[model samples]
Target chain A: MFLNMKTAVAAIALSAMAGSAFARDLVINFDDLNPGPKKGFDDAVALFQKENPDINVIVNINDREAHKTAIRNFLTAEAPDVTSWYPGNRMAPFVDAGLFQPVDDVWEENGFNDDLAAIKPTMSRDGKIWGVPYSYYQWGIYYRKDIFDLLELEEPQTWDELLAACGKMKENGVTPFTIGTKFLWTAAGVFDYLNLRTNGYDVHNALTAGEIKYTDPRIRATFSNWETLINECGFVDNHASMSWQDAIAPFANGDAAMYVMGNFSVDGYKNAGLTEEQIDFMPFPTIDASIPGAEEAPADAFFIPTNAKNVEDAKKFLAFVARPDVQTQWNKTIGQLPINSKADISDDKFIQEGFALLNGASGLAQFFDRDAPAEMAKAGMEGFQEFMLDPSKVDAILERLDTVQAEVYK
Target chain B: MTHAAVPDTTASARPSWVKRNKLAIAPWIFLIPALIFFAIYVVIPIFQSLWLSLYEWNGLYSADGESTATWVGFQNYAKLWDDPNFWTSLRNNLAWLILFMLAVPLGLFIALFLNQTVPGMRFYKSMFFFPFVISQVVVGLIFGWFYNPDFGVVGTLWKAVFCEETTNILGNVTFTCSRPAPDILSSPEWATYGIIAAGLWPQIAYCMILYLTGLNNVAADQIEAARLDGAKGWKMLWYVVVPQLKPATFIAIVVTVIGALRSFDMIAIMTQGGPFGSTNVLSHYMYEVAISEYGERYGYGSSVATVLFGIMLIFISYFLWQMYQDEKGGR
Candidate 1:
């Protein structure tokens, strides 16, 4: 009787194992837990699960900062089927370590070759596409429309025009631009625009790639223009003490007229009690006018880890995220522009403005921090903050950056 | 035939070796679990970190479970020597160590004041210890806002003295100061001191509680004897009370030294070693170089940790030696 009971237990356990094998588990790790992004991700997952009902989808959402550090450990120790990460040099280390698997086949099969063409170059490394981009947003000058109207200033189109506007605003007892460099990246946004405008896209790429020294004449020219902006435009005082969110106060209160920021800051302005009518977006004004304008648009993407248990389902999810209809619904909920060119955009004024700005741009940079290696980026941003605080120290700051660049890229 | 009887004879002879050495073996038996734990968690990591400091790694591993670290002996240390930021961090650490010592004397004073038998002495004691009960992160955030130059306590005070509020062109009220208010956290010169002041708040409370317990143990007869011999106030404190409070003072100093060395949380919450990395101590700098969003230099970060360990080693060894001497004297 005891022997018969043991056999019965073994049969039941084998059947249970077989039952779970039929409905495969696909685990996805997401970074952002903010309301809008979370909703977008949840909606996309729901749609995927509805179509692939045989697969059991398990989603783990983490705080973005925590996810960044956790990705290194989890990718190796307990790999997820799909994980959210960034594109470009930011993802280079993981790709080099053979932790992230190439999804070139996914891209080819889905015709992302054409739909996600804008971010194709960034997503590809080592002659293979590493991930699929879902959404990206443009970086430009976000200004207070009411403040501009009160000052009777038209959007500046040229370097001289911008300087003249700055002078007029300063004379009216208003700071022309407000920035907080406490976290350091905000200053890099300003630097990327200035460099891209002064020396063009190729120079920006070369500088970040460490192919050119920071003390090179072209880069020095960029610094000269930045110095000119600081001396004349005069960003809000004590900017070094404020975070990007804290800097919004001066702009909202009309003490400052403009901000060099990304599209994501719209929600921040709204939360600070400013209405849509009070604000407007403008492409960073032309500095040289000879160089075609290159705008900053950092993309967020998803990749399959090498140790993933369900490669088939992870690829399915990546392709689903790249679909035009799926991307349209996702980016719409998140207030961002979809990676799929065929995706429909929101009718919101700022979204429309951003879409138009990116559509007409000659090139798109993945921002200073994203384009550059992490070590170089940290030192470079600190130098930019220092220069902003004391423009007279430009020479010393550039020299210091040259030393770091040599050490980092080595 | 004799071998069969030998086993029974040895078992009964001399209580066996283990039974004879019971006093020596029993303590080790009790300590085996803790020693194993300490070896795994504490002792192993120190040597591992030291070994790791000689390599170049980005804190990643290959899919095959091999470390992605490359051996680059002493290169990281040589680089640290040439790096200006390292010097700045070291200087800031020195400043923290010196300023943090003030907590000991200040704590003693507060403990003395609270030790008197007033009407609501227990309530007053709890209130004095309240800062210690709260988390360090909260203290950091409170001080971060307190030092803000726009709407914080310092800013409001500055505005009241030097500025007038007026409506701007877009009809929003703002200040127009004759001279701008001080931005302490933004200025590289002052930011470190601002954070240190915040760290000292809770640390002082901690030291105060330690001394309060010590004060409870102070013999009333000894104090009376000192008083009858013309000892009072500073004389009483220095001659009679302080010698009795040696144990508390030693612990307070040790904790304060460690607290100064690990001054990461306040700087992280307050400025994140910002305004051009002026306020970094070694601990925060090591973390920034290893684990922060931009930092992945594990080998380099380990070298920084090694240097920090070296500094801490000096204090730790001195403390241990002092304890050893006290134990010997007691015997």
Candidate 2:
């Protein structure tokens, strides 16, 4: 009689468990190393778990470096229902191979199409939406306000005025520009800005895509301007030997004055124990006021695999994450602007400035690594480093880049 | 007729087969596990790496949407031949090899000094041998920080003494006669040499311990005998104590050569082949191309790896031959 009673209770418990597991399985893989993003990810996972008590949610988190190497493997085997990937050409080859699921109808159905007009270009290719953008930050100059004040220089609005300000900073015993090119991509930040200002967005895109050659007269002018920066206004000392963090040592010491970096570095500066008032942010000075197109746009997006078992769930999650409230919460935790227009943001000073700059962008091009194919971007950046070290090698470097482009594209 | 049932084992009837071949056959049984381990770890991977060298891959991605790699044949090898970076890496390897040999004699001299039995000599021996027992990674990092020009101890010393305007090395500078101390790790021309010097720190320590052990076993009675016939100083040391150090010198050379070739970690830590690929040795360069980042030229990277393997094989074969000659002579 006692055994029979125990069996009845066990059966009831088992059935209850089965009924609860009937909820959808949502698997998410995220790549974020910073503290803010990690918290945002954990908070979102908690909320998501609470909302769907029956669903079994699994989160796979990985380091950013490991994620870059693992992304290719994950796409084919043991693929997460949804994963994070970069935008532009980094997405192109994978998209072409049918490795990604199309989220277009979701865009139209979930109101993302009408609401996210600014980011649709990042998510769109050939009229089909491949991914959903979560968050993005503007790239620009982060300078030392104290040094500028000491030199009696106001923020420069024109190119010539910026150079004159730099000249004054140099005379007062401060490095006009400070960056670590030991890893080489920091130099590309300078180059990309110059290219955007010199040739506008379409031509910059064309150059990276191999449709235009580096030796073209337009590229030559960009190099000429770059050479002028290196020659006339010297950059930080020993830039070749330093990583980005190592370069910050000089900046924190007030030995160097300016760094052109993404908003991601704001937290790093704060962690370095600098007062917020000491540092200031500004956009790259415009080259031609009349030359138009996306002044700056580099975004991070999420996409679904073409071979996924849970496409419906994946699209639903993408749509769910795209909601204005979700965007607002995630971006607030991550210190970046949300892609959604309706998200209510804290009237934080930095976000307000970033939003104004973003909304006013004449054009938006993906970051160089995203805008160009992986192979071309890598070779081009290596050339950028070599060009900076010795401007005389510009012709050779351009020729080599062209050769790499021909081979890589083929 | 008794051996007919088990010819290999002596047919079991004539007093047990184990009695006849126990010396020879027992050894094979004893060595089986070790041979299996060798086959599993060391022997098979060599042939596998050789085979892998023929293909191109990102070391990620598989065919079924699982980061699959595509196979490209001689394209990797062909590209390796065309790459300027490959050539630069090879040249740097050769440079490392040539310079790293200096540690052997330096180690010998230090070992000779520490071989004495004065008061607290054991403590001195341990102190001298300290660098070798610690990890190579730590050694590399210490040297890296030590070479920092701004706050590095060596730099500070150099600046205080050599850069003093009152005592300039080359007195021709205008106003400030002091020239700055060299940025050893930063300059491409000297960066590989800097890493080699760092590598030598542990290697010298290693060689010193080996020589100390060899010296302890040297035939002292023979040295006393040689002294009876007027052998002294340079002659006594050269014709007598030097020859007895053959075993230690053999190990010292083998390890030093192998250490010079296996320079991946130190290079990775100290200088990542920067300043536009100036200090790249073949090993690090191959890794950078084959695996790091989204580097997709697996085939070309493999070709460089194969070429490095071939060079190492030549050195390994020669070193083994030398060891074989010594063993046969000693026997």
Candidate 3:
């Protein structure tokens, strides 16, 4: 009886040793709890679990807006192993505070430098890559195809052509653009596209970095072009009261024909009962022929917090997310473009069009709000809305923006 | 018995203290819990915000895990002086305070009308009080839809009156109005008034209920006596009914003033201080600066809060003094 008990005890000890070898737990805090993004995130987590069966994954999803505030509290106190955040200056403050871990090792191991070259500059600060970008989408003008066809108008390629098209549309009793600046960021999309088209990528960067003033002649030129757009290409009436979703009403009803928006708005248009044939994407018209074509493409990425308990697992998850196949599947599910250059894009027309537009661009800007500091972006977007409402306030708006820029950067 | 009797001396001594100070100490003993909660939740935070106003913090931590607060004495106040948004918010706040007072007279008028006996009168009174039961967020949303320029009631009315069906370059059916319809929530000049109107819907209901209760307690004999003395209609209401309803009027004014100052949630839900920050009040402006998605300028926000607090202090102190005098006279 003693010999049998000893053998049973030995067997239990051996199994416990085996269990200890693979004991690993990873926690991920994702921001978007919306249906599409949530499903995509769950699928990714499920796939990760299937690959590493022994590792346990804890996924905590939060509403996107609430996450914005909760992140400040969570990052300092009880950080997850990995958390989703934006790239560029949005991550700069956290990176500077050493809350986010530098994932250069993961990038090097996964050969992300070549694949994510387009977004590398945004993800890097102080010579270190802070996060792994999974998906990004291009911003452009989504216009009514039926309107263009009826007017016998081809897509405008230059500033003058766009203006002429706007004039013609106006004569036909259709507003050229529909924007809801109630949330303030929609106005910034217009400002970013104009600035990127008028000044090259360098000037745009310099302005957002606060190396140049808003009153600079280059920025003023951008605003002047914006003034022309506001005057010639009139937006929907009472736009400041409508949300981005609410603005879709006028567009869907054909009261407005064009919108300066992102690829995500395609789904919104579709959900608003607009058909696939009714909508088409075009790059923002060029203002200066000498300036190269650069586009605004905001990226969503995941980062490891410095206080993460499972650093190795977080790095592994990031590397897995960087895989071309994983990125392709994730972006396809969410209807956005994968950051991986080698990733396969679906044949959806808008996605195909956005891919081509971003690939051919000289550089990618992360939109005005993402590229600029949060404080500066807020004031800047408000100024843009003010300018859109009353073009005559351009000088005063620029002066105010300059003052805010000085204060923010200092 | 000798071994068990230990603390009877202390127990006996405690009864003398209790007997001598029971009147003075009993009320305080009953009040300690409430006073503790009041100090913790209310009194402490006011001073905390005041202290926080002198420092610049991003609501984040430094690399060393310390709070990222840098002392900047009156710089935030100095900045507030130059901020155009501040002046706009202050002006809107004043407008709200003045306009929201209309609820008092309107509520009293409704209360007087509903004071009469009629069939299903309880239902009517409850219906009139319905706006008070619904939350401000819901009211803002309902009003938001009511003011929508697309499918809203006002929009539909305007369309029927002025719009003509037209096909555009898009080859789709659309309506072109003779003139742009009034979109109160979107217009900078009109947004504050629109929100104030929505707010007053509930405020009026609240004041109405207050007056309704006061009307229930009115001396019918005295009212009849005034009527016998030839008081009628406006004179009867002004001299007899209104004079008797002074308590209700005072309470209504006090609550209306407080509601006007605490007009943050309505503005937050409705326009978010939008239409170029023209709808901002001090509270919403403070939130926009300190805690909103923009960025945490804690010092700047706290300074705004400090200014708001300073303004409220003047009225509150006067209110407290009045209450103190009333209490002394009653005693």
Candidate 4:
């Protein structure tokens, strides 16, 4: 009787194996445990599952920062069919190593070439697109509207105007800018905006790519402007001790007038008790008139791993997510701009302003950290922070950065 | 079949074989699981990290893909010589080692004070032990807030004592101290010291617990004898109490050294080796190079790990040798 039971169990297991073989399963590793992003991802996955009932979808979500370290291990050992990641030079290492599958065909099939054109260069490396950017957000000056009103200050449009506004703000006993550089990346945002404003997008790209030296005259010009800003319009005292969230306290308390930050930080400002009318967004003031304005917009993307067990299903999911409606809904829920131009954006004021700002830009440079190689980015941000803290250290900081740049590029 | 001719002799010898080998075999059988675990988790990884240090790898495709790690020999070590961060990390490590040694005496002092019977002494002991019970990350965070220059206790105290009320540029009231309050974590010169102070809180507690147990085992007769010999206070502690507490002191010193060397968590939580990477010890620096958001230079990180391992090996070897000598003396 026991031998008969064993044979029966084996038969049932064989049938189950056959049943699984007949069905296709796709594993997706998403990185965002926050309510909004998680809901958006889950809803998208549910939609995909409903549309394709035959396909079994397994969704694994993790904390964003944890995912950064976990991806390298998972992509090789237990490869997920699809994984979320950042676009730009961030994905370059994995792409160069051939760990990510090039999904140019999906882009072509979904007509993403036209839709995702703004972020195409970022998502592509070596002439093939490695991932699909689902959402991106513009970085610009987020300023206190009440402070500007109280000081009778017009929103600064030109460098001289900005300097004048900063002078007024300083005269009234306010620090012109508040930033937290403890984590280092906030400093990079300032540097990117300065470089983009001073020398424009091409120089910023060339500099990040190591085609130009840190001590180059153009780069020096950017640093010169930064020094002037630091002297005339000081950041909050003790910025190096604070994180980005911590910096918001002063901004909320009305001690600081402006912050150079991404759209994602708007929620933080609101949560810190600032109302919509109290805060307003502005394009980074122009430094050199000859250089057309280019804003910083870092994008998040998804890729199919090369070792994916179900490539077809992963591609289908990618294509589904790339659709304009899906992109619109997903981005709307996450409060980020969809890469697909046709994707309908939220009527939220900040979203509208970001859309206008990003759309009108001559070019988009991914923020400094995302643009440069990670090692160089780290050193560069540190230099930026040091320069902010002590302007006299500009030359030293730049020289040190040049050394790191040379080492990293080599 | 041949032994059947000498059946009585063979039967007697069979029981003798079991009797002779049982002690030898039994201990090894008991040790097998632990040995297997140690080999897998500890022994193997050390050699693997050493081997990896010889090759340049990004750690992604090197395992299975076409892009294999290139054998770079000792080039990673060569690069380390030129790397300023490495030197800074080494210096900071030395600082951690030297500063961390203070915990041993501090622990012993606290233990001695608590050894006396007093009102609610047990409660006081537990309260003193609180820092050690809490995780290092929490201690780092608590100290981080405590040291904040704006709203923290230190900042508030400084402002109250030394500053006048002034409005900032944005028309908000804030303190403008006559002498700017030191932002400890933000200053490269002070950041390491600040983190080390946070680390010492729990470490001192740990040492206190060790010494407390040792103090419980202290012989009453010996103390009386020392008192009869007119050895009291410092003299009693120096000649009698400390001598009896040698084992606890040794263990305390060994653990403190190891803790100092592995001082990554507090630094990671408190400063992240920042304000220009000033607080970095070798382990944190190794992590920054290998796997932090900065970049992955696995070969270089492995080289750093190898150097750290070498430093630790010296201490561990000395400790083992001392133990061996003590064992031999006991025999």
Candidate 5:
């Protein structure tokens, strides 16, 4: 009796697998912020659904990091026809393994070269396109304009001006900056920006990709500047225990005068009840007297997986998401700058500034995690956190990161 | 022989009935379902995990564009031998087990305090029992906030009184505390202790609840007899109550040991083995290697998990053997 039941169940399970394995259905599994970025994804899904009604579209939206863990499970169990992922060294291992569908054809077919130059390298792995560029934004300093005016600090134009602003903010009993290193990646924002400003964009990229060691002189210089900011200027109080959201509380209360953050932080500021006039944006100031290039890290992107059941439909979805209307609606909702140059932006001033800087950028480097492989990025970010908490352990931390890189590379 | 059997009477029927032995075979039928359950959930998975530890495959490589695994023999285990993160995790697990054992005695003391049959005793017992009722995630969140050095309640209290001033039990100034109250989560020296302390909050509650139930079963006749023999205070309770509470003490210690070793949620929530990865226990570190932001070192992670499983197995085997001996002695 048990054998009969087991056989019946096995047969049913097999039919379920066989039912969906080769269907023309195009399922796009999206990972974006719920209730906000989700709207953009839904809008795109609606368009694709309308365009191809015959194809069954499955939309699986998950919490951001949860998607990272789930991606592995999905690849084996029931991979979506199309899904989103990041680019850069983050894609290399997967690309090498053939997990992501190469979308060079999509790029060329859509005239991606003529316009989206700023976001090309992000989607490119080993001189070939492995994913489509959905959207990306520039990152920089978000500070309170009213507090800056109160302290008689103009928008910082250079390194000295920035430090002067920090000093003035500190003098008035306001914490100069607020950042939470509890999860360790916020430290990456500060580190990447500093590295980019110090040694230009290429060096930053090379360093993250493990071509340069953490103990390199240029890397040491970045740490020195990071150390100066912590030792003399001071960061927000009790940053080690706070999450990124918790850190926002101090900035929201105006207890802290400035926050070095991504352009995405604008929405958070608006939600925190700060008027538009109170919040303003600026480029991360150049640290050296003379620097080679513009410095900005691009945040958040999308890619199609290699195991996609319907490549043609996946390409169609990718191209559709790249359209101006989609980009405009998506960026506005997420409070980030659109990668598409033709996308119309609203009267939101911070978005305008972010757009301007991103337009004139000499180079666009993918954010630290995207630029570096996952293992290296993990160690690097942890090292940054440790250095911030205790600079004395810099040598040991760097050495450990170097050892991990050595093992992970081969 | 059949022809002879055709002449059967009551005596022949009685012989056939005697050989059947139905009562002796009944228990085997009853044991079959539980045996099958154990075979599937317990035995199969253990062997599978061990076999999987011999090969390298990202849990999701096939979906992402990667393929299946390559067998690496003992290479994964060899790599673990040289990995500093592995050593750090092992040290942290040991620290948790040692420090978290403090809960048993502490819980016993609290249980004794509330043992008095007075007004609102049940209320006090229930209040003391509250921490265990909440889930670990909530406990982790609450403790994470508590350890916040900026605006957390503990942080505020540390700043207000524990900063430089010292007070006696009666609140008189005795001397001054020289050093600052350490930043518990961030400091390498104290991060493990902080997590262990967080774990103890609920664990002590669990132990207290067990002991409370144990104390109810303590014999009043024996206590009165001991009292009549002039046994009182420390000696009386030690000899009488403690002897009666042996069963509870054994279970409490066993749970406390397991709870200490199994502390993963609080550490992950509070610190991701950070401030130089000082707070990593075996479980969190294993997860980190297996699936830390797409870390695809599957064989390596599994080996770490296997080591953790092995250690747990040693303790578990000893415990089972002890139970077996006790059962035999009881028989």
Candidate 6:
């Protein structure tokens, strides 16, 4: 009797597997569970399913942090048809491991070569494009427009004017900047802007790429500028204990006037009860003026795993996501910039300002963490946080970073 | 042929060798299932981790079904010797071990205090046990908010005592303090202690309950005799009650040591080994190096795990030896 039941169960399972195999399924693993990002992704997937009626789409959405660790397992174990991931050095390890399949043909056929030209260099490794970027957003200083207006301060174009404004704000009992270095990456945002402004994009790239030492004179110059900012235009007190969202409290309450942050924080600002009229965005002030500015804009992309079962459907989905209309709709809902140049942007003030800033940049960096190798980025960001907490430890922090860089790059 | 059949029937009727050894074989039959599972899950992974520690792997596999791990012999271990973060994690672990011992005595005192059969004693005991009932993650989060310098209890109290709330230029209410409240979780010197305090809250409750159960088994006649002989307070409790509570104390110390070694969740929830990795214990550091978003160094993490396992093995063997000696003495 047990053997008969077991045979019956095996037959049922086999038929169920056969049923799924014949249906032509496409599996997509997305990493954002936030309301805006999730809604945007769901809407895009829904539209794709509608357009490709024959193919059944199975979507799995995971928390961003959970997805980071899960991708390492799923990409190799049970490869998804398409998966959300970052571009640049963040994708290097998977690319090197032969886990991510190159999608240059998708880009070529979809005309993303010209439309997504800005992110082409970052997405390419070993002279082949590895993924398709759907959306990216700019990183800069988001400040309190009302506070700036009340203090009679214009957007500071240079470092000296920024310090002067900071002094005025401090005199008026307002902190010049607010940041939470608890997670360690917020410090990197500040560091990237400083280094980019101090020595320009090439030096920033060289430093992250391990070609230049952290104790090099040029890098030291950036640290010195950071020290000046620490001494003159101090960040909010006890920032080391707060997350980026927590730091928004001081900004919303007018305890602090400026935040060196990304465009995506607009949602957080709104959630914290700040209106559009109250908050504003500006590019980081120039430090040397000799070196041209390069803005930080990290892109989120999708790749087909090497072992993906539904490669055809995955490529179609990638091309579909890259289309101007799809990207426009997706980024608009998510409050980010579409990678397709032809995609129309919303009338959002921050989006307009970010668009102009990126348009005028000498180059676009993928942020410190995304640009540097993971180990190097981790060590470097920790060093940045240590330096931020205690400016006097600049030499020691830099030396430690030099040691980590040596080990990481080797 | 009839005589041979008769002799065979007589032999079959008698008990066989299998029946004779059934007493010895029954326990082995029952134990085999659990023994197989233990070998597969526990015994195998410990050795696998030890083997993986000698390689330099990023925890990735190639397109083909082959591991991409490269053998680097003792390079990962050699790297740990030079790494400052490893040293910090070791120091924090040592601190956890030393500080966590306080729970035993504190728990004993609380157990003694609550041992009396007074009215509403059960209510008090249950209340004392509340921390243990609540999850460690919740404790970490509660303490994290409590120590916050901006909107937490510390921040609010600091503002009340040292500062006045005033409207800023933008008509937003903000505080101007003589000095800022201490940021405990952000400060390297204080963050570990803050987490340890959170850890101790639940741990003390656990040890208290262990002692409470032990206290119930104490002989009333012996206590009365000790009281008649003027053996009271600390001396009576130390001389009479403690000697009898040795079993409970052993288990408490064992659990506490194991707890100290596995202090990962509190640190993960509270600091993530940050304000620059100052609060990392060995387990959390291992997780950080192997599993975190920026960490894929499986070999390095395994090496650290192996070192942690070695420490745990020593403690476990010592505990086993003590238990063996105790059994011998009892016999």
Residue-by-residue lDDT tens digits, candidate 2, A1-410: 35324433443354355556545666677887677887877676666555555555566767788778777777777778888887777777678666787888889898888788887777777668899888888888888787778788888775788888878876765667888887878888889988988888788878877899898999999999899878766676566767888777767667677888888887777777767888888878877677763556688888998767777878877887778988899889988888888986766666777788888776677778777776677778778877887899899999888788887777
Kindly report which residue stretches of model 1 are placed more than 4 angstroms away from their true locations once superposed.
Answer: A1-24, B1-13
Q: What tens-digit string does per-residue lDDT give for candidate 4 at A307-389?
A: 99999999998888878999999999999998788989999888999999999888888888889999899888888877887
Candidate 2: regions farther than 4 A off: A1-22, A51-54, A92-98, A121-128, A293-297, B1-30, B60-71, B154-181
Ranked by DockQ, the better of candidates 2 and 6 is 6
Clashing pairs in 1: none
lDDT of each: 0.92, 0.77, 0.89, 0.89, 0.77, 0.91
Per-residue lDDT for A173-236 in model 6, tens only? 8999999999999999999999999999999999889999999999999999999999999999
lDDT of 3 by residue, A69-118 (tens): 88898888888899999998999878877889899999898899999898
- Best candidate per DockQ, number? 1
Model 4, backbone clash pairs (residues 3+ apart or across chains), number: 6
Candidate 3 clashing pairs, residues 3+ apart or interchain: none
Q: B53-153, model 3: which lDDT tens digit per residue?
A: 99988888853478878899888899999989999999998999999999999999999999999999999999999999999999999998898777788
lDDT of 1 at B245: 100
Give candidate 1's error at residue B19 in angstroms: 1.9
Candidate 2 Cα deviation (angstroms), residue A155? 1.6
TM-score of each: 0.94, 0.88, 0.94, 0.93, 0.89, 0.94
DockQ comparison, 5 vs 6, better candidate: 6
Ranking of all predicted structures according to DockQ, beginning with the best and ending with the worst:
1, 6, 3, 4, 5, 2
Per-candidate Cα RMSD to the true structure, in Å, reads 5.2, 6.5, 5.7, 5.1, 7.0, 4.7
Better lDDT candidate (3, 5): 3
DockQ of 2: 0.26
Error in Å for residue B148 of model 5: 2.7
| lDDT score of residue A184 within candidate 2 | 78
User: Which stretch of 10 consecutive residues in model 5 chain B shows the poorest summed lDDT?
Assistant: B168-177
User: Per-residue CA lDDT of candidate 5, range A271-341, in tens?
Assistant: 88888888888888888756755656564555676666677787888887777787888777766666777
Pairs of residues clashing in candidate 6: none
Best by TM-score: 6
